[model samples]
Target: WSPYKLLTVFTFIFQTASKDGEVRLVGGQSSHEGRVEIYYGGQWGTVCDDNWDISDAKVVCRSLGYSDAVTVLLKAAYGAGSGPIMMDEVACTGNEASLMFCRSNGWRRNDCHHSEDAGVICKPNEDESGSEVEGTTHVLDRSMDFAESLKNLYETRQFCDFNISVKTNGKESETSIICTHRIILLLNVDANFMVKDGAENFTLTVDEECTPYVDDFIRYLYIKKISVTLKSSKCIHKLASMYGILELQEFCSQLFTQLLPEDLSFQNQLSLYSYALSTQDTMLADSCLQYLAWNCKAFAESEAWYQLTWDQLGNFLFRSDIVVPDEFFLLEALESWILKKGPNSPDLDKALIQMIRFPMMHPEQLFQLQFNFTLYKSHQDLFQMKTLEALEFHTVGFQNLNQYVDLSNIDYMPRIYTSPTWSYLLSGSSIYNQYNPYYRYDYQNFYSQLRSYSSSFHTPKHTSFLFQSDMIQWSFAYYESAQSCRNSGRYCYYDNYPVLLLSFESRPSSNYSIQYQNKALMICKDSYVSDIRDFKNNLVVLPSNDTSSYTFPCSSNFSYQYVVRPLYYSEFQNTQ
Candidate 1:
């Protein structure tokens, strides 16, 4: 019989049968899924779900006119079932025509309570226009016939807006999936049935019955938007992986076009590294990795660095890019990570030490690693070979590159910025600054005034500073002068371009924003460098290194502190 006809037959037997000789679903929202009860001895009784599994749930689903069982729920998913505990320890091969056709401990013989009653949510089959197709919709981990016709509606664009009410924090948010032409090329899932008869809009009212799927559905709508820019790095990564055109798929090219490795914050660089790995954006990933290697000492001590797994920690120690102040930093960080795991922790298996490049290490570093990792004579030759390879690389780079080690299941990482190397020298600017008729410096001079105001300060992460702490509707950045340029002296000159290192006790900001306190007025870059009045149409957001002290103007001693609005890290993710 057809799947639909069989489902109808089960529904018939479940709903009505005078002699009580068939199985039926009860206490559910629909006929095809719910509590499992059988008609036996002129009375309906429930089944106990002892050792129930997919094979058993499959039989239950197919017999009731479903494609297959999605899940096996215990603990009385449809509430306590009354009457005899008809079947126990049921086992099936998923090809059985009925529950009785499968092996079981037999009727009314079970060591189960009413709470252990077996239940199955089955797939609904559709046979529209007499030429139906057969396929299963996987939802909640089950193979079910679900919304095939509606999937067609989404594809055809022959529908109106549909409302889904999502409840959160005891409140409902009405979200809409609008029908439009641009989405025609997208949202293309196959189906024939539709909810609308003419043009009436459909409202999917979600309440207590389906509370679990509310948050998931809301996220689904946001993902469907395929916005050009997204705020969440997680979400943007999700869409890019799923759609291939959303975010990171082409981001490698984007990184090449407009971004340098130095543009991103430690957090953003970390995210971009993972993003690069996933999308095979090798150039970006390599650049980010190089930064971490170069600053091995600082990163090793960072809160984020300690979070790395043994594999990440080991790999960094073994890389050639880790040449900051020399490679001894690798041995120290690796030993630190291992000690944190405890001497007996399996994660510190001595075999992993082989991954470290011994030859590249200075003699002292080799002695250090041996003290930490080596003890067995059986692996002596292997360690010796690795040492030679490291020496070869140190002497003449990699004469022959080996395959990279594998590190799986890593979902996220942290990042940091490298020191600045300027394109021009700023020496000529000092003389110009002294004679420029913008404004005269106070007795504090440039250098002394800067020392009075701590260059480093801390602020909470905000998208925009509303002059208020919470509920910031509009976020922005403003510069406060803790120190003046008169004290900076020669340190202010970089590449002949008037550059200054403005250090405040600041966490790396997400983006750059500077609106004068006058509200919305900004000083453009190089606009009246020494004058206060030139802050009208020109506000310069100096290049950021995304560190405690970011790159800013140093030629003038204008007391400047930048107020920045929080931003989606991805939006400015090293925007090349």
Candidate 2:
């Protein structure tokens, strides 16, 4: 029978005969719409259905092994019923029936109750194996094993491949055959089958229930999960490696740059430059040094440089070395740039002053020039006097008289008109007057005698001053006279005195004013002062109309004294 007929047979048996708790078989059909009989209580019966169609008859005929079915009928009772009808008023269409028995709609409507419900039965051709058999027989019985049965079926059917084997009850079962690459018929067996490796297992099933496709679906899931995992791990590793390398480079570069500037300060720029030039990885160091040079030069010319001393430079350089090379180079470059900008710039002068003290050949000339200017301004008069004294006292050292003296310029000799010695002489005995005579003197003879005496003596060429014991003693003896002359009056009379005097007048007291007397003192805190010679006693306070001025004496020991009188005023007012 066709597979559709077999399915109809099973469905009919499950729906009709099985519901009655009996096992019965239905056969002997002719057309697709064939009559079906049921045996109940040892009597054969027919079923009648009013609502019936060719589709219902087809199912009945196919279940009974007929080729096809055409029509179905229904009635109150089966027509010509001589036996007991299991169910009357059977309702069916072409879709009803089973190979076990034709199905009937139980207890349906009836027009005439006296007529027996009857159904027609037809016989198919005797040679047509599609016809139903009379009684129960072993239709599944076969001598061939399961494998042989499956092979025979596959040979008979061009659309099937019986590659699988079935074993039942310790013997091969001839139960079913499967179509290749399509249906997998597992007959009454509970066992897993393995498809060959690399072969695509498309479908998996157990007892006709579809399950997961074996090869492609499972492999796709594994591949997708694994691929994602591998890619994420690789990305994380790559990122970690990149970050670690970058951080290492940054740290190394920082340290390298910091050490470079010190090499420059030590006049080892060439060594540092060569080291950087030789190393392929010294780009950071090179850039740093170049920047340092430029910045430091700029800083040297700025006002901030002037405020910075050598000690401060040492501290800054030491601290900067702790940073990375790149940072160090950038900062050094900025500093060098500042230095090069010059002293008028902020702090540049102070920095240059500190660096100038270092004994380096390149900067020595510049240092000397600056030193010369400062020294000239600080001691210009002393130098001038020394020069004049050297020329006068050492005239005889020159053998050439014309080169040593200009006799024609007699008026050039300093006259005694403003001399303190002359003033003293005028106030003293008359013998000083004859010795001084007039302002006129024989400068030619004096210059000739001085030259002759100096020519007879010998001294070092660089030594401009002649040291004499008598001259020293005489200068020391007149020290108190010089000091007295300096403090004698409001205005200083001695130009040679080192000290300068300044005074201010106190205001007169008034009835509206409150007078409180106090004193202010200025103490030298520096260690340089050892005596009054090193001290500035020039700052003085004097009472109005008084000749005497208060002086704060210099002392090595701890001492305090009143230096200035109280500040006095007629009235107090808030200017702010």
| Candidate of highest lDDT | 1
lDDT of 2 by residue, 1-576 (tens): 443333234322212122221222233233322245555444554544444445545555565566664344444222344333344334444443342233332212122121334343333445544545565533442222333433433345544332332222223333232333212232211111223332333232222111112221222221211121221322222222222332223223333433433332333333334444444334443444443333343333334443433433443343211111122222333335444544353344333233221111112232343344443343355434433433453333222423544422311111111112111111112212323222223656552111000001111111112211111000000111233433333343332222223222222223222222212222222211111111113221111111111111223221111211111122222111
**What are the per-residue Cα lDDT tens digits for candidate 1 across 1-576?**
332342243322122233332678888876567888877566687877777888887887786667877777787899888755677668877776677656564445444567788887777565522345455543341112223333434445454344333333334464535443223222432100123244233333433434444333333332333222322333333334444442233332333322323332345546556666676655456655655664455566666566665655555554533433333455456656666665644435454565553543444455454456533233566556666655443333111222231111010001111111101112223333443233336776743111212132333332122212432222222222222334433222121112223222333433333211211111223221111111112232222221111111123323332332222232223311
Count of backbone clashes, every candidate in sequence: 47, 80
- The TM-score values for the models, in the order shown, are 0.31, 0.19
Clashes of 1: 47
- Which run of 10 residues does model 2 get worst, by summed lDDT? 448-457
Q: What's the C-alpha lDDT at position 390 in model 2? A: 31
- Global fold similarity of model 2 (TM-score): 0.19
Q: Give the Cα error of residue 516 in candidate 2, in Å.
A: 99
